[model samples]
Target: MAVVGSGVAGLVTALDLLDRRPELTVALIDKGVSGESGSTPLAQGGLAAAVGPDDSPAMHAADTARAGDGHTDPRAVAVMAAETPARVADLRRRGAVFDTQDDGSLALAREGGQQVGRSVRAADATGAEMFRALRDAAIEKARNGSLVRLQGMVVDLPLATTPEQPVIGAWLLCDEIAGGMATPSQDAGLVLLRAQAVMLATGGCGGLYAGTTNRDEATGDALALAGRAGAALQDLEFVQFHPTGLKSADGRFQRFLLTEALRGAGAHLLDADGNRFMLDRHPDAELAPRHVVAKAILDQPGGAWLDARMIPDHQLAEEFPTVLTGARTFGFDLATEPVPVEPCEHYMIGGVATDLHGRTSVPGLYAAGEAASSGVHGANRMAGNSLAQSCVFAHRAALDMAARLDGAHADTDPEPPTFGRDTPVTADGSERTDLRTAMSAGGGAIRDADGLQKLGQVIDDLRAAAYRAWGGPKPPMVRDALEVDSMLVSARAIVDSALHRTESRGAHFRTDYPDHDPVWAGRRQRVQLTG
Candidate 1:
């Protein structure tokens, strides 16, 4: 078995697989250092689950369904809510300590869209702490037996000899950065691995948008790779824009995400006149659903301001030390001033369509976490639900895979493909910068038909240009091929899906169709590449 990506979902999946089936052989691959690929490491708002007597799984599921705008699958939501408690307990057993109240019960806080206090956090650095815990557990398991960790970029999924045959494994292009070339000096550029099953936990497609809280490596490579290999994608148009992303005066540096937990802890959203604007937006005001808050910010005159002054100074330093410290790094004191904010691409509500057990349309392939649209989040994802979803689905996928391990056969390993190694394979800084700039300009928030159409054309042109300059049977072409292919696929998917919706719903707001159409209510737009 092979698992791509090394984030919380991937790591948890591997750990669960090992725990369930100790004799199974698993190889975990990551492009970067294990645990740094997905937004899991940067998650600030904790996991959302019914951890207190005051909160119930029904209420949690209702909020999830409501936020998803009636499109959430009830079964998937039930599975997530029902299994979340055990998942949390498992994390605790593995040394993940959650913040607790004086009475010894878990400390629960509220975030946007939650009707009850259900978010379980570990200080302000929830993602970092969770990553450390999971990473350590995976490493310990590997040391004991059976798991292998590989650091390299996956170029493509190698299919069986026949068309639409089950994916056997991946073709990896291991480029040598120091000498700016491929290995073996002349040929043998691609390395092949055979696996009985493949799991893609490759995070979200947030990088397709201009302003996003996603990591730089989030280029939608996994989604594109899967799509090219015939995976069905759903709800691609339902991209969630977080309202409180830290924005500079010039609107640059939009990656910083201010967690909604701050508001749950009594912070406020103020405008330029130092007046609370959410009061006029929704009854819940500062704690309204994320889509409502984000739309409110978009409607506000000059974006919004996150006011951290409502909380006490010492308490602020204690609960959200990471956020406080990060604020200081940007020359601001959170306890005194309001942070300038705007909505950026925060999460992709849609991804590779999968069942409750993380099984995709194709056999022997599974996906979990942000990479898979498991029908838990629907149209708009709740603030703390992502982490819980990752853990729950990872466990499910692992269990499902373990059930099939006895009969699973060794994949027929095919001979490696050849490529020219004489060409340079160094990371092109200029190309990377260009890709980022283009995505930001054409695909940023507030996109229209014209902008998307033009963006698609430009991306196609860029892909063609890259191929012309570097494509010729060389290993260096692998990065160019992967990056361009992923970008084009993502752009096209978003644009096509956005065009089909034709109505303003959830995170998708079209100025042309300013109001939600009753006819489109209860419907999800699915996208697939036509032959």
Candidate 2:
């Protein structure tokens, strides 16, 4: 089996497959180095699970449903919440250590939308700890010949013998940095490997927006690849914007994020005059659902700030070393200053649609992590729920893939297609920066119909220019094809979905339609490419 992406979801999926079916050969592919593409490594908040004695799966499920604004599938939410405890236990068995209280109970912190303190963390760097453990486990297994780590970018899913047949494998482009140089020799060109099943855990589409807490590789590659292969997609418009990204001096840009965990730990959101703002906006104040808080911040005049001064310095240093260090590096003291903040693209609430078992519409294909819309985070996502969702669904996908392999089936792998010999080279350093700038400015937190329409046109023009520059009639090499195809497809999807959803709901707010409509409630709009 083949798994794309090296995040927590991909690594766990691979490990689960190895444990479940030791005989199956698995290949794991990633665009960057292993453990780089996923937001898992950058996550500050911990996994949201009912690990406390006072917590229950039902309570977790209810919080999830309520946060999603009634669009969440009850079955999916229940499945995730019910399986969360076991998943946490599995992580512990694999050497993941969650922070514990003085009384010997698991330390649970709260985030937006939770009734009880249930977020399990590790020194405020929860993602780093999870990534390290998962990566070490996967690497050990890979070294022992249980799995293969393909360091390359996946271009497309190669078709099987028939259109209705299961997917056999993917076409890959091998590109890795060696000796501080990016070598693009033909020896590192296209490669094809047959697999029993394919799982896409390729993170999220956060990079499609201007400002995001996601890493550079979160470019919607999985969604675009699946869409090109005709997979079903849903809720493309529901992109969650976190309200606390550090703002730049210009007031038009944002830097890295200050996690929602700070608020859960007693920090407050204040206005420029040092007045607490959330209390006036919502009864729950800082503990309100993510979408509500984000919208409130956006609506508030002169923006907002996060007051972290209330926490003791020694305790802050102990619990949030990452944030504290980052603040120091930027020449600021978190204890004295109210951090300037604004909403930024924080999460994708929708992606390639999948079932409870991680089965997509396409045969022999499954997905997990932020790339798959399993209906867990419907219209809005709750803080810390993403990590739990990834872990639970990764195991589910692995089990389903193992089931398919155990059943009697004929070999369906087909000869892979070849790209043109004279494909255009991918962007150099300067060109890549330009592309990012264009995407960010044209598509950001605030959007108008005109800007979105113009952005769509710009993407189309860019694609045409890229095709013309390539000089050959056939598609370019896997790397170039993947980059161009992903950008074009993602841009089109976001623009089309934003245009279709005429009401302000969740993360998708239209200034043209400033008020939410009852008719638009509880409904998710699907997007597909049409002639």
Candidate 3:
């Protein structure tokens, strides 16, 4: 078994599999250092679970459905909401530390679109704390030799010739293994690890946008690889725009995310004129669904500001030490002044289409986390549900894989795909910058026919240029080139999906067709690659 990401989803799957079958051999592959890849550690918000006295799975499901704007699959959302408490408990038992109340019960926080406090957190750095726990557990497993950690960049998955043919393995590029170069000359160093089952836990495609909260590694590699392997992707246009991202004094870290917990704790959103504006936008005010709030912020003439002056000073220090430190370092006090903010590409609501068990259209291939669209989020994601969805579905995938691999019932081992000394795409940093700019300008918080068409043309042009470079006499595989290729591929999918869906819903708001169409409510837009 091979897990392609080292985030919460991938690690949870690997660890759960090892726990179930200690003798099983699992290869944990990551694009970065094993425990430090993807957007997991950068998560400022917490995970949602219906463990509060006033909360229930039914209530959570309703909230999830409302947030998704009627496109959410009831079954998938039910599974996540129902299993959340158990999953949180499992994490707690495995050394995850959740913030506790005075009585030591799990302290919960609220966020946009939630009716109650269901977010279990460890200060404002919930993802960091959760990753620390999971990472420590993985380190233990590695020490015991049940798990092997491989650090490398995955360029492609080895798909079979037939449409339904199972994937046998993947192509991995490691600096040490590739003799310090990813070119075809170092093909000997490019190792192919065969496995019975492969899981894609790679995170979202936020890197496609110029303004994003995703880490650089989140270039939609897994989504692009799956698409190239002939998999169906759903709802690519439904990119979730977070309502509040911190504005950096210096241009360097301007994309840093300001967690929604501040708003959940009664913070107000103010426009540049020092006016409380969200009150007029939605009845829920600061707690309106993410898409609504994001649009309001984007509508601001100068910029949006988060006013947390109403939140008590003691609570700010105790409940959000990380956010406080970050704000103070940037010369803003959360307890005193208003922090500047903007809308950022936060999560992609669509991804590799999969069932609840993580099985994709292609056999022997599975997906989970942000990489897989299990239909739990539908058109829009409820706040704090991303981490929960990742954990629940990843656990389900691991269990399913473990059961199938236990007997000879698994598909027979197929021969790995043969590779030629392939020419890799060439690097041009400007191409990536241009792609991001176009994606943000045209396909961002709002989209229409003309803008989406223009973005699609840009993607086509950039893709053509990349392939031309690749066709040049023996180009070696460069990381930057591959990243741009993946970004372009992912961006195309988003543009195509946005173009197909003419009506506005969830995060996919179109100014030209702003009204949500009842006809398209139940129907999901899917995209696929065909020869």
| Candidate that would win on lDDT | 3
Sorted by lDDT (best first), the order is: 3, 2, 1
**lDDT score at residue 340, model 2, on the 0-100 scale:** 79
Query: Per-residue CA lDDT of candidate 3, range 1-531, in tens?
Result: 888988999989999988887888788877875445688888877999999999999999999999998899999999999998998988998899989989988899998889999899998988888898988888888777778777777777775566577776777776454321111123324677777778999999988888898877789887788887878888888999888888775644366787999999989988888999988888889999999899898888888889999989899998888888888877888888999888888998899999999989888888999999988998889988999999999999989988878523234444543332365444547778889889989999988999999999999998777667767322245667768768877888889989999899999999999998988978987788652
- Report lDDT (Cα) of residue 248, candidate 2: 72
Candidate 1: global Cα-lDDT? Answer: 0.78
| Residue 228 lDDT, candidate 2, scale 0-100 | 67
TM-score leader: 3
Among all windows of ten consecutive residues in candidate 1, which has the lowest summed lDDT?
A: 179-188
Candidate 2 structure quality by residue, lDDT tens digits, 1-531: 889988888988999999988877678886776555678889888899998888899999999998887779899999999998899998988888889989977788889989988899997889889888887777678666778777788877866667686777888787744411111223476787677678998888776656788876777887887876778888888888888888777755555788788898899998877788788777779988888888777777887888899999887898888887886676567888888788888888889899999988889888899999988997888877999999999999888877778634436655665555464654543333455566666555556677778877877776676656555434567565556557667777877888777777666777778667888777777766541
Model 2 spans > 4 angstroms off: 176-187, 251-254, 407-442, 472-475, 478-481
Estimate TM-scores for all models.
0.92, 0.92, 0.93
Candidate 3 off by > 4 Å: 160-164, 177-188, 248-253, 407-426, 472-475
List, residue by residue over 78-120, the lDDT tens digit for candidate 1. Answer: 9998899999999988888889999999988888998888999
